[model samples]
Target: MATQAVTNPVPVADLRRRPGRSASLRRIARKKPVGAIAAVICLLLILIAISADLLAPQGANQIDPLKNPRLLSPSLSHPFGTDNLFRDVFTRIVIGSRISLGVGFTAVFIGTVIGASLGIVSGYFRGKTDLVVSRAMEVVLGFPPLVLAIFILAIFNTSKGYSFRSFLLLSFAIGVIIAPTTARIVRGSALSIRNLQYVEAAESIGNTSFGIMRRHVLPNVVAPIIVIASIQIGNAILAEAALSFLGLGISDAYHPSWGTMLQEGRPVWLEAWWMSVIPGTAIAFAVLSFNLFGDALRDVLDPRLRQSS
Candidate 1:
């Protein structure tokens, strides 16, 4: 008796077509208005920060003390108006963006680097190292970021001379404070990615743990970490400003920081509203943009959200 001939099923390209089409549709659906506005705002702020030197009308800290009278409203000469000391508010705001952006980006960079490293190690190892790092992160998370910043600034001011030390201290403190969140995010992402089939395949092929993590796991986890860090940059900027406004941040009173401006303007708010108003708006918009852009990024990057759409 002749055996019945067996045949494999034909591969259909159409099977791949729907998913691709659906994915495209989903991408379109995930576009949110808030996210778009946020991204634009964030981009605008970044541009402003980058071009601050060129954009600013004069030296950030320069005080005419005579040319423009105090409390002058917005005008062709001074768009944001002059402060109590006849300092150009527009110039100060332009220059202040540099400081805010600098602190925010620096802090986020430090936090993300430190957090991602610790998180990757902790998640991959899942032993004493993880326990220690997790516990330490928890402890750090317990304190209010502002309070911790104040303590750190106080210590630094007392011990080290204040010029760059204050700026460094503020960035370091903010980085440390924000690190726990990044660590947690990275750890979660690593944990999920660690058990994927590719990871198992790499292990089966005799790839070292470190090699597998570095090559395969880290790349996948880094995307979310990057997005988080981007969002966190704005928060860090705001935090630094708050600390400065509270007199616990950058010690240079002469520097043209939005926070410093706010602090200086507090007493003269009624007299010189422009001093605080312009800087305050700048801070608000910068923070808002980062947050909104981050949200948009999340929508754009999230596979689940994309799938739903």
Candidate 2:
């Protein structure tokens, strides 16, 4: 009688030692160095955003009474220095990350999910629906995104001051600004998906149009969606910051936004450079990291780009 062979269990440690995240990361680094760097930066940003309370040295709004604390400048004691209120700039920035990332991600999610669904329907049925959707997208595209956002925020009665509800409203406004572009991109990608054999098979199998779009069309077009989403997260962040700067957004004293920081600093900037420079640098870093990661993701994800490379 032949005995069944007993298999030896591999340790989880051994599995890790063999090839996995590290190997994939190394391959990514080798194939796309800039992308890898950008990925690291984005990761760091996320980590900081997540651990803000733990990492911050002081309360976001705690006004330190330390001698001449106002705009003390960056040093060992205060990395980002103090603001005019003697509040910790570093702490405020850290806390502010919660707001910025929350808005950016939420807005992008709203925009992408809504836009992708609309786009799939528009592209899958290319008659009157397509014509109407495409024209509507064009009309939305015709407006300046920032201006549209400002208008929407105003219409939503954001004058009630920046509360949790108001922040959500601001996010919705920004999401609307983002939706048209995402719709256009997803629409273009969905168009090609219609000709795929699987799509035909799905239809032949009596799969509902929605099912076909959800299962086949959506998955096929995900690469572009991912790249667009990454890029748009950064845009959403910038929009939040810009609106905040314009006094049309976040202004709660307890909350510290880079845009609001900039607004506060604008008057006293000459007297205290860190007030402007530090928050400005933070904004730049976030936007640049996102843009770089998005560009790198596009290069890596796009089938045409992958083939060319």
Candidate 3:
């Protein structure tokens, strides 16, 4: 009689370790040094924004009555110099990070969630549903995003005074403007995923449309959504700045955003270059960081990109 051979059980620790997948920070850094650096800068900006209370020597509204000190060049005391209002440009710039970053993140969050949800429904249902969503998205896309954002924000600003609510309104407007693009991308991804065998299998097994979307469709499209969001944040930031510069956004009495700084400095540009230059530099740096990080993320997360590299 032949006896069946008993197999030894694999160690739990060994089972946990997947081959060819080293989860090391050093390895990640080596693969994308530029992205890593950009990420660090983004993290630093977040820290500065969070710690503005401690980092900024003056309050956001603190003013220097001294004419000589006002519009002075950058020095050890005031790294970003003073603005026309005698307000510490550095303090405003530091605190402004919170507002700018907040808008970017909040707007993106709103756009992605609403857009992805609609996209999933449209793609999964197809037929009339797809036609409706696609046409709506096209209408949204036809409008210049900046113009649409300004229009939406202006509508909200008519009766309401500036407050935290105003910021929310601005964020929401931007989010709505961004949503159509997000929805289009997500819809395309969902469409592809819907045709896959697993989705068909789920359908065969009598899985509900909602269940299939929640468990399958959503996950597949998340990567593109994230990539889209990262880039959109930069666009949102620029739009906010442009609106503020045009005097259509961000009242100075409430918050001194970088765009407000730019607007304020423009009148005194010849006298004190630092006023416009410093805040302008900050905006450029922030936008650059987002773009770089987004590109890096795409390279890392996209299987096609990774395979080509």
Candidate 4:
């Protein structure tokens, strides 16, 4: 009799997953050059924001006529020139990053926590609970975010003025404004995960609703949360800048901001274009970076998108 020949079995799941991940990475690396460049730019901006104190020889709010000659163009001493108040534009831009990024992060964090909680609860428990939560979210979402934000700011800042406290209020307002949309997104993800086999198994095994949501639903929805955060932060940053430019946001002279910088430079466009252009460019790059990163992240994280690619 002839001896039987045997072959090694392939780990189908592992083989499929590994190559897909690698292919996705390579695709992102090769195809999305703009995203990669944007990521690098964001990293550099974040670093500059973090190390503003060390990097900026002049304080963000410090006005020095001797060193910062008024309306001076970009040069060695003051790289981004000087404003009308004879303040270093470079220093302002560096320091302003902290405010912009900080507000964006804080607002996004608050929105994520509240939105994810409502979404998970509403999604997991259908019927009355879902109806109530969904309706509430819809009501909130009906209003325009910028308009809502403006209303909230107007209400809060009427008596408080534009102090650090008011600054926090602005972030909170933006967070609340965006939470409904986030909740809707997370709820959709949770609704899908709620009916999955593993979730059913956990339910059969006496897993509490909270436990199921906390352990299974939240984890499954991480991709949406991340994508939302990336995109929302940029939007929030832009909104905050717009508010500041309109003299409704951070008006405290101590904290230098890109929007306020634009406000300052608006009158003297011809004399010192760098003053407005520099900060405007910073705002544009920051927003662009976040949007690019969000798109790249969505491509990587969404299985449907990966399959399509």
| TM-score for each model | 0.85, 0.90, 0.90, 0.88
RMSD (CA, Å), candidate 2 to true, equals: 6.0
TM-score of 3: 0.90
Candidate 2: 10-residue stretch with minimal lDDT:
153-162
Worst 10 contiguous positions by lDDT, candidate 1: 157-166
Candidate 2 lDDT over 30-65, as tens digits, reads 988987898899998889888988998887778758
lDDT of 4 by residue, 1-309 (tens): 897766876778767765577776667878677777877777887888788889887887787788788889999988899888888888888888888887888888888889989998999998899999999988888888788888888887654335668767878988998898789999999999989999999999999999988898889999999988888878888887888898877656667778888888989998889989998998888998899888877876889997897
Worst 10 contiguous positions by lDDT, candidate 4? 155-164
For each candidate, C-alpha RMSD in Å?
5.4, 6.0, 4.3, 3.6
lDDT (tens digit, per residue) of candidate 1 on 1-309: 998765865468755656577776565446676776666677787898898888877776676767776779999987899877777888888777777888899899988989998899888887798899999999888998888877777776654323666667778888988999999989999888888899899999999989998999899987788789878988998998998788665535345678888888888888777778878888898887888778677767878875786
Model 4 sits at a Cα RMSD from the real structure of 3.6
Candidate 2 collision pairs: none
Query: 1 or 3, which is superior by TM-score?
Result: 3
Higher-scoring candidate on TM-score, 3 or 4: 3
Q: Candidate 3, after superposition: displacement of residue 2 in Å?
A: 28
Instruction: Report the candidate with higher lDDT, 2 versus 4.
Output: 2
| Global lDDT scores for all candidate models | 0.80, 0.86, 0.82, 0.84
Which segments of model 3 are wrong by more than 4 Å?
A: 1-16, 19-23, 66-68, 159-162
Give residue 279's error in model 4 in angstroms: 1.3
